[model samples]
Target: MIDWRQLREIITTPDNVPIIGLILAIAFYVWYGLRQARANDRLIREVEADPGRHRKTQPYEEGWEREVQVWPYLLRIEFLAALIVTLLLLVWSLCINAPLEDPANPGQTMNPAKAPWYFVGLQELLVYFDPWFAGVALPVLILIGLMLFPYLDASPLGSGYYTLRQRRVALGAFGAGFAIWIGAILVGTFIRGPGWVWFWPGQTWDHTRAVYETTRDLPDLIGLHNGVAKALAGFVAIVLFYAGAGRLIHWLVTRSETDRRIYRATSALQYYTFQFFAITILAGVPAKIALRLLLRVKYVLVTPWFNI
Candidate 1:
């Protein structure tokens, strides 16, 4: 039977409220953005088919100036938007209580002690990865990978417009990462219960629940017993993954003629940099998650210095 009370408690938690809001807001924006992108793509196709006819992406009366004054036109919209947001915040503050708890006591630690919602994704990673990797290395890699995107993307299309046909690869990579990050946050907030145990939305939070599942390393699964041998096997596995994933990503990103042209234009340095980040961050996150959750594999790469 479903534990509705437990689910309600979790959903109503002050700390979780913003996450719920974020999910809703992101869903709306994604739908709206994709809808507009599709429309723009269609318009582009029509324009290309018939260049003799002049067409604007947005329909405007003839003789209307392409640009409007920023002082009243743009600032008026911005001011209204700011007022709406401010009013919403004011209402929210009055309705919902702040997520403040009693002062911390060493003797009374909260079960499933979680970070703030924003950092909860990283906290969830700790369950599947080593502390150094999940907490420090992964976060740094994500930031660097994000910063490298503009430098790596050679596409001139979709600069001033929203269109999937023009920026599929770029959008797809970003979307996948974003989806994974949001999924982690959702799981950490709602699925994790007391003692950090997995609990479905309607499942009761069993404080006394004790799970004793044994997790195995990748090398150990294939009968590699010696320390040096296990490390070698793991290193080989990581290298193979990178090699295969790079090829797969390259094929996917360079399928279209335009994409292939962009690939040809990209420098060797840029291509390699893109592959490194895409394989490690894009392909690696889901791969590790599958290994950990499905295969119960821990530490695919283990060495004296660190484990991943």
Candidate 2:
């Protein structure tokens, strides 16, 4: 069980105020889900009572009624938006001073030395993965995922409108990822102290505090620790997991002939590759958490070149 006081202390920090953005994002999704549920219920009831009421709705007329000219009207709105953003930034800059540490010294290293707030999430991931994997490979995969998302997400629902019911999977995945990244940044900024020890808000930063977390490698967990054997076992395990999951998804999800045709038309190998990368990136967090909590397994595929 987590110590609520410790967790709360980690969260409740002046420097960690931006973490509220993540909380707000989650709350917004909760509210959106509720609203979408109510909307769905109403639509179902309406359809049952009068099936033809909404069915006969004509195509949207994209004339003056549905369109706005890009003149004084749109221009004025855009100007006000920019003005408000600029004013907010000006006020924020005035109120909060930027954090500037002491001048760089080659010999004097700051314990828990963090990247900028934006990159803090990736930095924190170094705890779970090797520097090359966390700092380089994952970041490259994220960029690839972003570039490949539109191709993967073929759904046409919620294109212009903001409805959770229409785009639940996409939005939920993105929101969860965003929350994790923000949460990592918050932890790095507020909870981590000297030597990267976990420190709460009320607790004093004890420089001598030792955080000795023993992490078991994947092969060690399954009682195989020979280097070559472990590497081969790890590779086989990952391949099996990926292939099993892909087969399960392919079998379980009932797709139409047209969908199958589309899949055939596209590069199926590329599609599966992208899907695997996406799954690993998104599911890795929860997988890591579960392993740490249940088995005290720190790294899954630990090799010389990479660790996850």
Candidate 3:
């Protein structure tokens, strides 16, 4: 449906949208770094100036320790979320009845056959580079970067206190990344406009399925494809995993040891294991999704070692 005349005529709309977004991003990061510098700059002292007397650290107070034990409050909120999710899942399972396709036909594949929701981002990435790059190498690199954040930017500002602005910025960005990942699924399902086709499993599989079946033309912008979306997703993940979320995780897990190297190594090892499990599960997405739907099985069964 794309012709030179029609394409040329469609260029009246503004094309600087992504550029504006990039400019805003650069400006915000610069501002954030400067603000951090200012906060730390105030704490700096001149070596030649009068030496200040440092106060001795006090022991933990009984009253303050009692106030910190809000486990009951945390547990109650967590249980409420779990109960709501379980009820919604029960309703969804009953209402949705998926029909089994005729025994995996090799010649005739289903249109828009996708992976499970958890692995959709990785599956989308697989479209960009080779399976090894998308499914393994990139995820490994991401994991390594996430684990190295503490050592890279060791600003012990909020180590013992919760009033640091850097912590707030990091937490906000981490929450935003989670929101973005969830938002991607919504956009993929609801906002993917017509006639756009990009996937080609083999060289022979012509990318005409969506083009032939759907209405409206695909986007011509730089980041309109699934591949670009995956890259954006990864970029956001890096922000959360390393810059934002990693800072919070470092504070949390290594808190008991005065935040030492041993604790950092322990947290990194835990992250490493989780990354491995996630990557493995993501690689088998196509089959995993098919089997789960067909057998009505959950990923985690009720075993003594684990509970779903």
Candidate 4:
């Protein structure tokens, strides 16, 4: 059932090797961070129960000052880290060949022509979204959303520390967006084959393979054939989706007393901004992905200027 040869070729490609390394690094760091967070959370609970006890989340000796000089204490460690990274880069450069191809030819194009690995996620989004939406609007929204995070989040807990229980709503929203981006990259790298068709990891990359699947827009499914009717239908559907998803996310975020307090402290502007980005990016993305993949529905919202 598995084609080892095909899988080997994909994994060994020079352009793909970095993605493999990225996956490993992400896994290790997430595990380590969560482990540390658990330990710190336990320490926090103990200190809350017994205020007389003196404890530090980090290791501290009795004689050391609360802070140290940055020149030697911090810069030295940074310099050493830089040197180690340089050495590793040198070794890696020597071991692997650069992924370069011959000069481009106007007559022939490479099958499954892909963007650089970093932009592969956006490229994969083309399957489910229009070019303008995938390439421009989504990226702009993501940048703005990131910039708005600090202002939007009113929580003071878990500052400068890795603790999930204290910052569940903030962490959950960010983690969901990050996971979606990473998933898109992985799918683009390993699962997309010639013609941008979906292929299982072990399946052969057939150059001549032709898929003839028909996709439909949501409006078409409900017998809305006229252009204006389709547009109106799509607009109504999107409005309803936002209303439902916003309510659900609000309930989830305000389940705990801490969360409810934070929510109450936030200004209307901040709350609305957070809800807009959360529903659009965090919830809208997976919803669209599901529609496209499972229901074969495209362009849930179609207007004269844009189709989403």
- Candidate of highest lDDT: 4
In order of appearance, the predictions have TM-scores of 0.97, 0.75, 0.36, 0.96
Per-residue lDDT tens digits of candidate 2, residues 1-308?
44666556545533444556656876897797667555655664576698765521224433527566899889999999999989987986787666566999989988767676678888877776678777899889888877877777656544644454445555655666777777777777776777877676556667789977787877797899988888888788777767765665454322555345435555666567645864577666556656775777776776787666
lDDT of 3 by residue, 1-308 (tens): 33444333222213322233444775797577556555443333321153463211233444464443458888888999999989977875586444455888889866455554444455554433346655776567556645754544334545542333334433432334444344434333222222224322221223354443222111212233354554454345434434443455445535544345443434455555433423333223333334343543332222223211
What's the C-alpha lDDT at position 26 in model 4? Answer: 95
Residue-pair clash count for candidate 4: 0
lDDT scores in order: 0.90, 0.67, 0.42, 0.91
Compare candidates 1 and 3 on lDDT and give the better one: 1
Which is the leading candidate under TM-score?
1
CA lDDT for candidate 1: 0.90
229-266: candidate 1 lDDT, tens digit per residue: 98999999999999999999999989998789888989
Off by over 4 Å in 4: 61-63
- Rank by lDDT, highest first: 4, 1, 2, 3
